[model samples]
Target chain A: MTDTTTLSVEELTQIVTRIFSQNGLSALQAEAVAAVIVAGERDACKSHGIYRIEGCLQTVRAGKVAPQAEPELIDDGSALLRVDAKGAFSPAAFAIGAPVLAQRAKDQGIAALAINSCTHFSALWPEVEALTGMGLAALAMCPSYSTVAPAGGTQPLLGTNPLAFGWPRPDHPPYVFDFATSVAARGEIELHRRAGKPIPEGWAIGPDGTPTTDPEDALAGAMLTFGGHKGSAISTMIELLAGAMIGDLTSPEALDYLGTTSLSPHHGELVIAFSPEKFAAGRGGDPFSRAELLFSAILGQGARLPSQRRFSARETSLRSGIRLSAAEMAMLNEFLAAA
Target chain B: MTDTTTLSVEELTQIVTRIFSQNGLSALQAEAVAAVIVAGERDACKSHGIYRIEGCLQTVRAGKVAPQAEPELIDDGSALLRVDAKGAFSPAAFAIGAPVLAQRAKDQGIAALAINSCTHFSALWPEVEALTGMGLAALAMCPSYSTVAPAGGTQPLLGTNPLAFGWPRPDHPPYVFDFATSVAARGEIELHRRAGKPIPEGWAIGPDGTPTTDPEDALAGAMLTFGGHKGSAISTMIELLAGAMIGDLTSPEALDYLGTTSLSPHHGELVIAFSPEKFAAGRGGDPFSRAELLFSAILGQGARLPSQRRFSARETSLRSGIRLSAAEMAMLNEFLAAA
Candidate 1:
């Protein structure tokens, strides 16, 4: 009855689930993938939601990612766990490991897990947010291809390496945030460039190793780390923490490794979970109360806490339904027809 | 002889030790305090070094901090340990808890120690850097009196909130970094205000609730968080992790509690240590090999790590003898003359 095909959350999830299964993913794998896609779509994430369906299917078709691969828990000892994702999508691996990681942290006070052989291209909030319900704090990061330059560097030598952290709240939503150490997201600069708008100073540099306000020049050159040298240092730490510390490939190494694959350029990730209750000690046994003080302070200042926008956005989309463009719907339907 | 005195590290330490001891601190506490002060002075840290002597002396003089106090560890049975500093200098607190934190981390794979009821007015890096030598990755953070405002907020409601991280390297010096989430150091802003200098855009807001480039107005209002909202979010996390999570006072509360004290406002801190070997699970069991890969790549890029400047500065100062200004020398000698 409507000119736009406004689909409810259930409808969107069903469609995404069916498409993945039609393309050879097992029912469980399809469901895992759909949960991530629906999360993105529900939150109005343009790049990571339905827009990524074609690329994801093509990556699976290209044999870069396995449609029905089993992510194995390679080993578990001490406070660290290692998982081999078996070339599956990271969300697929996350669905399998999130519960175990949370449980392990509850038992051990603090626990860490690193997922390898993964291809991740989604907002990391959901993964961390999941752990918060059980009162576990989580920290996750991953390396992709390098697109950012180091501070004072002439070439692009780092990725927009994402870092996410989550803390639990007893009565309300948990505090969760994920951010790239870069000055601006790559697409954000590209949007400014498209609109013929100037970018913020210190956001990027031209090929001549100078900062540029022209997003186009910056894009052709390299993005700068946020907060000058501090952000670059943090980026380098992420490369080491997510790459070398976890026994995976660093950014440059990942690019080289992926060059040989028919798969996409993205690869590998590291995830860590912490149990607040298990690590709880100093606070006369009431860490959660102190956490709420933060929420009260930020909201009192009329500023939003990190990830607050996404929660509201998701609620709206779920209530009003998700709207997909005509071209995207056609492309998704085509996948089913071909299968 | 020159008006500016050039003292060796040992001479400086002895002078600082004597001053603290004369000021009524126990001999052991004096030596511990002297080590941190000398480290800052040797590194040419203008604020944390000699400039802090008066405030330190006054806090002791006012009987706000106990000079002969002992910091005790209250065990939590888990990997986390809690140290009650009993109102000593943070360095004195560190001198006792650092070894215990490292040992607990090594024994449990990952351990955290929260130091409570301390007055920290020094650089946090040395605390984190000390853990690196033991092959444990360290993260230390604390909330001080509020001076920086949250992004989009009109008032200064958050502390500069320093967070530091240290990663161990096998060959080169450890990768260590400490950053305050604020746009600029408060002392730096105060200097600009004194000199009638203008602050940079995006650095602060005027008291009239507008973005301001005037240092005086910004100081009267609030210093902006670095990297905007991302920095503010990180600052909030530190306040929770170091303050409420550990059952200590937040910045505003610390200020309220210190309203009657002659002590310059700084209170409490949280320190954590992680054993890298305990968390190693990938890299064919050769964790160091993967860690090296990070060093190899970043060095190959020509950009320097965060601590490089401080290291070079410290070495030169140590070799050439630390030169203290006439005013500073007079202040140090006054502690002796007064005693």
Candidate 2:
């Protein structure tokens, strides 16, 4: 087996930032994008961390993604905000957009940030988690080219559209979850395929509309919508809410924009934030205290919150170091040499 | 087998409205609530139709629900509105809240209506469907007393929260979906139990947390979260969104308020409406035209939209009349006689 490399967050961020700078991003833009990936690394979410650096590098190299474009903001009203990402690196746009969303939600009761023309290339949790840190409830949904079929159908007509949510949890880390509407995210199937592992039965169907345990067939064909039709409906809603509502390409439209009929799904994202204190009736005390009642109930049942694992992993990695595969380390060295 | 009774929409509405009126609801309140049940009846959604009429009757009789109370609205700003349901039937509150939400969304870009003190006892689709009829998109979520077990735990701690969403579809009836975050609604299990049918595996666990196909055990024990952990996480988010964030009772609190544990869930709901015309860019035309791109894509794949079945069922029922069993007809007669 290849050796694993231990890298501190500071070390990885510097190297990744330098590589992004060499690949046409401004220093600030590079740092912003690198910070997102590094945070994912610190949480040990490989699909979003160093594992995705190559994808980001390729998109930047092809001139398909703008590295230094300034995102445009449309000030609609006190609670309404719109943004045009202008083909920029998605994280860079969000870096400019998230704080504005949180502040507006704070000043007003609720706020919506509609982001268009973004080439979203990171996990959705960071933006939402940022909002939660500011004591705001945050929601983010994004659409991509189709890779999931509506339940009861054989064709892939919906993106594995992801939805992320974040809420404050009193003294603990903010409660957060970022998940794809698909039964399983595509990266997972690829991981299973790479590991030569048989996939679970309910995870996906082959092109012939039959159950398949082969990860390769599952990925090449389509993943099942989570919980059948309900998940499919949720994905369709995301296609409308995050895609059409935000004035960006829907899943199919993303294919046309990307010049691909059936390959990768890439498109825009939408985020909304709500201020907790503004709308509370105090019927059940403060929001967090009321939340504690449910939290205690959940814990009493020996069930863990969805965000606990990621938050725990992040804490451990930050205290010690993030782990990277030997291949990932080599790839970083190659990028450093090229830079 | 007992004979089936076919009742016209008008006949059913009259019967249901009369029963509510005799049960202390005003003519307007009775009509509003009956209209929702009749719509469910027209869609052949028996679970939300006559089956739930008794729940409404009992809650009103128990004096926990105000059948004739007027819902109050607090206008927070251009985009935010808070509503007090006055402990009224959810449909009546929505009858008062939906139009105002739609109007505000039309005037502003987006709007939210936080409904508090509601005794929601019907399908959430009608409220969102009303928004869709006005050429808008809408979302609604409501919490109930705990019935679903969190993913890794034996004890039930979260409500089988139902989330409903709607999107306007040009000339056709709007696309709409209302789904519980649980594997199967408890009402379904009760129906299976009544019919002497076996509940599906993976549908629920006995109180012991081991899988059981006995519908009775499933109902008495706990419902499984749909798609395992992800669905549980969604239910948790709903608890925050519809429960704590709105300053209403969360699942446990709802149980405490109701003075029962593991009984029927009763709690509040939250609704949001979005005006489609407000945010569209001319990149691929208006939002509706852009949405047409997705609608065409879905239909082209020989797949149906999520709301197709309900919409089509409603049309068929409208033409052929709704079907009810002998028992159901007798129950309606008894209610009419009592009224």
Candidate 3:
């Protein structure tokens, strides 16, 4: 068995923040980014946890991200708010805009915040949960570099765009779900390739436009969207709303700008907030109570709600410390030392 | 070959309107409902077309849907608009609220319309198309009577909820996709049962919660959501936003209220509209033109857009009237004579 380490979320966050701050990131960007990474670890979402620190540093090293650039918020007194990240990392921009977006949603009953020109490497749950924490339902989506193919098409024209949503639960943690639109994430294919295992069919298509199970071949070609045409349509909508409508890089354009996916994708994001109280004002039942009933029905049927496991892990981590493999600890130490 | 009759779109609309009006519906209600049914026929969506007219009449005959309940719009001048459908057919409620929703979206950058107490029998594309026609992107979703199981559960606890999205195009038909979240529509299973054919795997589970291909068993059991857990999550979101949050019956509640799925489900609908011009304000490029590039890339890769087939069929139908089978013509004549 491998050795392991346990650390409080705050301790780990401080170390990660220090690494980014020491390297190049401004205090605002470093702290904001660290909070998301630590939240992932706290929730046991290892994919977005400490494992992502290297990618953030690499993007900074590649000079593709402006580490010290400040995010600027532009509000025209409309429900729409814009945050120009000035090519910085996304966490800072989101932090600067989320509160305002929540206020706007409350005032207008619905609002949207568009974050542009940022390097987005984190999952959207953190951002949505932030809004849900403020008693508002939220939806966030963004395009990555081109990696997935549209349904019935051969080439990779769509990104594995991620969509995340959250609804506040007065008596419990917020209901949340964040997922990539693709059948599988690129990292999963990379893992399969590293393990010399064949990927499952329907996960990807080869460059020749035929479905393939070989991880390497799949990597060379394009990933497929989940649910075939339905998933593809939603993915395309994300590109249009989060990418084109926001006047930022589309999947292909993002890829062209970066010339490679090795570093984080620099793109924009769209987050919409809805005030449930305002929406349910003149309606029948209490929205939150009604939501609980639906949730209970789902649980009573033996189906789990999305993010239940994460919330459970979070509870455990709050009581104890987050457990980490020895290798993960070593990597963190190395980053700290290097910085 | 089956003998067929052809009729102009307007002619068919008039016939359908006459049937509804003569049967029971007021002129306002009849015209709105007929328009949606005609649009389905015009788009060649047979499942939602003239075949659905019988269901609407059945719903009215059952006294489950009001034939003359004028929809009341309650607007607080906020971004959220509500139309109390007053147990009437949904088409009329949507018609009464769509223009106000469009204007609110334009004024606020984002807006939502909550349609409550409506008996929804039509598809959501028409509602979305209405807003898209006003140069806004629209999203619509609503719950139906329970007939689907959650991703990991056995019993039916969710609806075959539909999600529809529309994006405007300057020179072409607006980009649109409307689909049920279920792996397959319940009608498809019914058709398979009628044909004595088995359903495909992953479409449903037997009452025991085990996967089954037998159409009859699947129908008696529960249908699954598309894309496994991901689709289930989306379906659940629809229930929350359109059902619970909107202060109306959820899928199970609708089923309980109706006690059967033979008639249209009485529930609420949620439609959100976004002004692309408002969202893309102070951003770099024209959102519409940028979207065209993305669309071209998809088409360039031999992938077709979601509504292209429907659009093409619509073009053909508009030029040379909608062709219906002789049996279909007889059915229409019977309805008219009976009314």
Candidate 4:
């Protein structure tokens, strides 16, 4: 059997933070970034876990991100909060704005946060979950680099924009879901290409604008939006709301500025928070208890909640530590040495 | 060609308003309901047009709706606005609250409106469009009676929940999209059954939890969500935010209370409005012009925007009055004669 190393969540977070700090990130940036990456690993979401460290490092090395920049919160005392990342990693920006956002939601019953000029590479779940942890319902979305096409179109005009939402639950993990609007994420297509496998039909189109299953062809062309036109419309909305409306880069503009998809895309993100207590006030039922009934009915029908797998994995990780393969360990050591 | 009738938009509205007024709806409710129905017919959305009138009458006759109940707006001057429909049709409630919601959005950068205890039967596009007309971006959602199964399960535990979004445009019709989050709308399946045809595979499952294509079997069973798990997650978010969080009926709860789907379901709605001007306050570009570039790029790629068909139909209806087929004309006359 291959060798493996088990590490506690705290241990892993420490190592990750050191790597970022050693490479040039400020303490705040390193710690905030490390938390999300470690959370990803703890939840068994390997895609967003340690595997993303190299991308973060690459982005830093290319001088694309301000490693030491401190995100500034521009709160005008309205229902909207703006965080200027000043071209830094998104996690730090989000970290600085989330608490204020939650407080504003409580005060106003609804609030929105706009994080601008950041290189965003993390899943939105962590941000939404933060609000949920604060006893609020949250929605988050952002536009990535252009790689997905609108439905019935061949060119990459829209990003594989991800939309995430979370609802607080008492004495249980919150209801959370984060997903790319693409039929399949670009990373999934890349994996198929690396494995010499054909992608499923409808995932992408050839450069010539025809349906394509060949992974290489899809990589050269564009990914399709999920649910066809409905998904495309949603992706477009994300571009308008999170990108353009926030006075940030649209997917195509980001691609043009970056020139390649290898580096993290620089853009803005929008997160909206709603206070359930405020929304349900003077109404008949307790929102949290009513939500439980809906959840139970869903589970009773054998339908799985979106993050059940992640939540369960989290439970195991908390109890038994995180297990990393020998290859992963070697990669981490090499990164540390380089730093 | 069959004999048909053509009527100006105002004429149709008058007729529809008269029918509702005659059927016991208060003038406030009657006029608001007529406006939406006329708008739907003008836009060629027959599914939500005059066809919905019979359902409304059925609900009124069954004493399930308070026809003369006046909607009350409860605003605490925060970002959230509430409209209690008092068991009347939803349009009047929305009409009463929309202006305040728009003003709040403008002042606070973002705001939400919750309409409770309403009999909702109209498509969400009209409400979203109203906000867009006021130069605000809007999102609206609500639960219907349970008719669709959550992804990965067989039983119907979720509604074919409708999600609608709108973004303002400077010199054009606003970008708007409204769709049911199901593989196929329940009405489509009913139509197939009436026509003795089969539904496409993946649209639904039979009562035994097996995939089915027979229209009859599918109607007796449960419908599937669009885009599989992703769409299911969005539908669930609607249930949490618009239903339970707002202290209104969830899909199953609505079904349980109504005991049938033939009448308009009594539930609540959530509409959030965002001010692009407030959001793009100090950003580099104008949100509206930037949006135009994105829209141009999408159309440049040969892909169509979401409401192109509806917009074009609306133009035709405006230039030359709305055209109704003989059958539709006969139906309207029959209702008028009865009244």
Which candidate gets the maximum DockQ versus the true structure?
A: 4
Candidate 2 residues lying further than 4 Å off, grouped into runs, are A1-7, A260-266, A282-284, A323-327, B1-7, B260-266, B281-284, B323-330
Model 4 reaches what TM-score against the true structure? 0.99
Query: What's the lDDT for residue B303 in model 2?
Result: 76
Model 3, TM vs. native: 0.98
| Residue pair clashes in candidate 1 | A183-A226
Query: What is candidate 3's lDDT per residue for B50-127, written digit by digit as tens?
Result: 999999999888899989999999998888899999998999999999999999999888899999999999999998
Q: Which ranges in model 4 have alpha carbons more than 4 Å from their true place?
A: none
Q: Individual DockQ of the candidates? A: 0.55, 0.61, 0.83, 0.90
Better of 1 and 4 by DockQ: 4
lDDT per residue for candidate 1 within A267-319, as digits (tens), equals: 56767676666545545657787667667877887878877777787878878
lDDT of 3 by residue, A93-212 (tens): 999999999999998888999999999999999999999999999999999989899999999889999999999999799999999999999999999999999999999999998999
When candidate 4 is compared with the true two-chain complex, its DockQ is 0.90
Tens digit of per-residue lDDT, candidate 1, span B196-232: 8898798888887689999888878888888787788
Error of 4 at B113 (Å): 0.3
Model 2 C-alpha lDDT per residue in residues B30-94, reported as the tens digit of each score: 99889998998898777778887887887777777877788887775546687787788777777
Predicted structure 1: lDDT: 0.78
The alpha-carbon lDDT assigned to residue A225 of candidate 1 equals 84
